[model samples]
Target: MDCILCGKCLEVCPLLRATGREELGPRAKADLSALLRGDAVALDAEDVARLAGLCLGCRRCREKCPQGVDVPALVAGLRAEHPDFRAWLWKTWLKRARELWPSSGMAAKLIPEKFQPERLAPFLKALSLLRGGPHVRPFVAVEALPDLRGETVLLFSGCTARYVRKEWRRAAEKLLEAMNAGLHKDKFECCGMGLESAGFGPDAARMREKNIRAWRRAGKPRVVTLCVSCHKGLADYADGFEDAAEAGEWAEALTPISALLLDGRYMLTENAPARVGYHRPCHATGNDLDHALLASVLGERLPTPDGRECCGFGGIMQLGAPELCSQVNERCWQSLAGSETVITGCSACAAQLTATAPEGVRVGHWLEMFDL
Candidate 1:
């Protein structure tokens, strides 16, 4: 069946709202999918690639579509048909993040803007985020640990936590140790969402396989993820497992660190920002436990009305259309109002917000709010 073109997706799409381009929205993408499948449009490989690059991979369209159409998945399939240099760059960056990320900020700094081509500009901006953010004082203090009785929990620290934001990993480990939960570390690769969005399907599969094998080798301990995207990515691995029981086990083993803190007690520190805000990740669920926990801890400081803004870090779109990504980030920050500090659960969102935030505005992971 063809897309009804109900326009529901347009209402929630950050790219469309930010750029005011109907063609960039999910409704148009769905229509484009139908046209492509029917051979109604004769788009060359580059044209197809450009069309695919318009998406943010937020999955907001999938949630609002009446037909349950996954527009991001459709776009990813389209992208897979036309591989390009951007895909190769993203694959190399994600796969070799450990070796590349730590020094990326320095590399970005050393290169002059005049020497950098437009295609390499977005990556340079991404590298700047790896350089790190201004130190924001912690606001929440762990008064006590939650009663979590289990085997040694494995930390599924994404690329950001592993390299760029090592502090997030340390904070997570501190929380786990405070709860007396033994911590296990592994050499996990990129969550593959980055590669999958960039149209490198085979590489994405290998990443998923590598992570799953690492989990299995660790004796399938309850996995705790620091970043929201990492949680979604690891949880998504269930679909690839051949055995139904194993799939269920894998799904059950995945846990967001925020979810673990729902029952734990916390107190706002004296240094808490008077106007703190939360930036909801596009990949995050409708009822985000991270926000919920923050609300419980922050009370009036964490306002509910405007915390739902998308950070607009559009995976490969960052390289494909960096200007659009910047526009969306601009709109996201505007929606945040006059927040003194903004916290997020997704590493990509944190990076984007940190890179684009106005002067004097601070951005960091929600984990950083704690004095771990």
Candidate 2:
């Protein structure tokens, strides 16, 4: 591993800004890994462990870096080399919980009933009222489109959205239906983003195979996902596989819901109330097409100054590093400072921002704002 020491990764690193520690940056970590290969570094395991844990794995650096270093993968490799039981426990338990009780009903049972919003800032507390609190609804699978219905187009609803954020699926289905596109529901599983993040690639691969076979059944018209993490996983499905190109072909195509929604052909109603601010999830913003589409959908509702800021949820990073999550959110909060409501396509972003919002700010899904 050669370290070019390009500060590109540091520019978008949420953890670096939160902790004010340069060593935690991707280039620094890459350099340390390079040194460990040549010399017997004296750094203790605890210090090494802290550095690995600090990464949010948002992959923003991967897009910015000219050296083409896979920073998230490097960090995952380091964490696997020096495994931490606590981190493993948290990740494993959460995955198991999601799998076993994969429904919003389970989330209602798991989350504390009398949760104290006071534990967060008053602004966050006020924003929580807009969402009405965590409630579970039944998961409704996306139905295949009627006209020009393709035999393919697998719909992969990852575990989190399958259970906790079912409404997003509803929104996606509505949008796709409007496009006259069909969706195949067979042979799909969770996209394994949680497993990949938790250093359980073998299991993630197994799940990926199951979904691939499902897509193959329909000859893979196109893969559509409501979750940004799942969208990224589908896009990078070919990365390490020997038959990557062939396996990736099984997807035929992969797209987020926003891409379909903002196709320009759709006659989207433009009359909506309240000024909206768009919060770009790290995954969506990192991709050019999805980012642009989401912005276009927001249109004039999008806040002028800093409408493109990240909400800083980063999958399970909010739970893993709460303080860092808060700090990163503070930047987003400031960017969306004067908006009546903040809108985002990602449920994780919505939840995290709502949890940490400052006074009088409201959090909502972009679809909810429009009559779509």
The top-ranked prediction according to lDDT is 1
- Report how far off residue 148 is in candidate 1 (Å): 2.7
lDDT of 2 by residue, 124-146 (tens): 33234324643222211222223
Model 2: runs farther than 4 Å from truth? 39-41, 97-151, 239-245, 248-252, 264-271, 285-291, 294-298, 304-309, 314-320, 370-372
Residues 1-372 of candidate 1 have per-residue lDDT tens digits of: 457878888888888888888989998888788878889357788888888888889888888888888898889988888777666666777877877788884444434465446755665765676456664568788888786656689988898888877888999988888888878878688889888777778888988888888888899889998888888877767455758998899888988888888888888877889988788888786668888888888889877746435677788787778888888888888888789998888888887788777889888888888987
Where does the lowest 10-residue lDDT sum fall in candidate 1? 107-116
Backbone steric clashes in candidate 2, count: 2
TM-score of 2: 0.79
CA error at residue 303 for candidate 1, angstroms: 1.1
Clashing pairs in 1: none
